[model samples]
Target: MSDITIRHNPDRERFEVLDAGNVIGKAAYKEYDGGASPQRIFYHTVINEEYGGQGLAGKLATVALDETVAAGIAIVPVCPFIKKFLTKHPEYSANTAATTPAHPEFLNEPSPRARA
Candidate 1:
């Protein structure tokens, strides 16, 4: 295993995990910035199946959450992986927020994921 790197790709609104400079996984989010409280709603995460059991997802989640917190933005864990990660990491509770109805409604509509 080579050095695993995680970087925020704001253009994609996702944090990508790279293995030796090749993107192997990403934790995707949708950022809502107009409101008084901005948030990054994480809804998808995926790692190359070949990279399974390597803890890449955990690392990806940790970096994603940490960076989101550092940015002073709330994290709305809409993805099962992220939601579960939050449960075991209560330290992040201060920066976490419940998904509101608007979140669901927005998710239901067309999105970058759908377009992709």
Candidate 2:
């Protein structure tokens, strides 16, 4: 089994999962200045095809959400994968916004994964 290391790269606005020094997955988000606190809108998650089926996505999501909660930053799970992941892991729900807009404009924007 390969050891996976997760790290938050704020400059790139993403949490990367590395397998032996190679990036294998990422969870992307956009940050906003929320007055008294910061907010993060998670918009995308991707794992290399070769790294699929290894539960790396879940691991990435766990770390990303965990860190955001630790920092007291509100989370807006706009990405379907993140929404679903949060649904399955209800413990992290407290870190999310009380009410996310039904349709966020950012959802319509093209994601890097989509552009690829």
Candidate 3:
């Protein structure tokens, strides 16, 4: 497999993961400044089905969360995938908004859309 590179495209409000120059996955987010601090809500993540089960999703999550931390922006993980990833990686918790729950149980709860 070719090396995968993750790049943040603020104009698109998402992070693109490219494999050998071709986009294979993307993590979409929305920026908000209505809170105490600027934050990004990671609302969706998707990878080409062909790229599934290869850990590409985890890699994309890592890059996206790392960039959010570096920019001092809190993260609201509305996407179950991202929430689950963060649950396993507590180091990224510091970058989450104060209102975000700290327990994995809360993070793992299914969203309304998922429940339906």
Which model scores highest in lDDT? 1
Task: Write model 3 residue lDDT over 23-111, tens digit each, in one string.
Answer: 88899987766578888888789999988898889989998999899999999888889989989999987788744543334445564
TM-score of each: 0.89, 0.81, 0.81
What lDDT would each prediction earn against the true structure? 0.90, 0.84, 0.83
Clashing pairs in 3: none
Cα shift from native, residue 100, model 3 (Å): 8.0
Q: Residue 8's C-alpha lDDT in candidate 3?
A: 93
lDDT of 2 by residue, 1-116 (tens): 48779999987899999988888889998875643567888988999999889888998999999999998898888888999998999898777874355326555667566699
Which scores higher on lDDT, 2 or 3?
A: 2
Candidate 3: misplaced stretches above 4 Å?
A: 98-116
Model 2 Cα shift for residue 35 (angstroms): 6.4
Q: Pick the candidate with the highest TM-score.
A: 1
Model 2 compared with the native: what TM-score?
0.81
lDDT of 1: 0.90
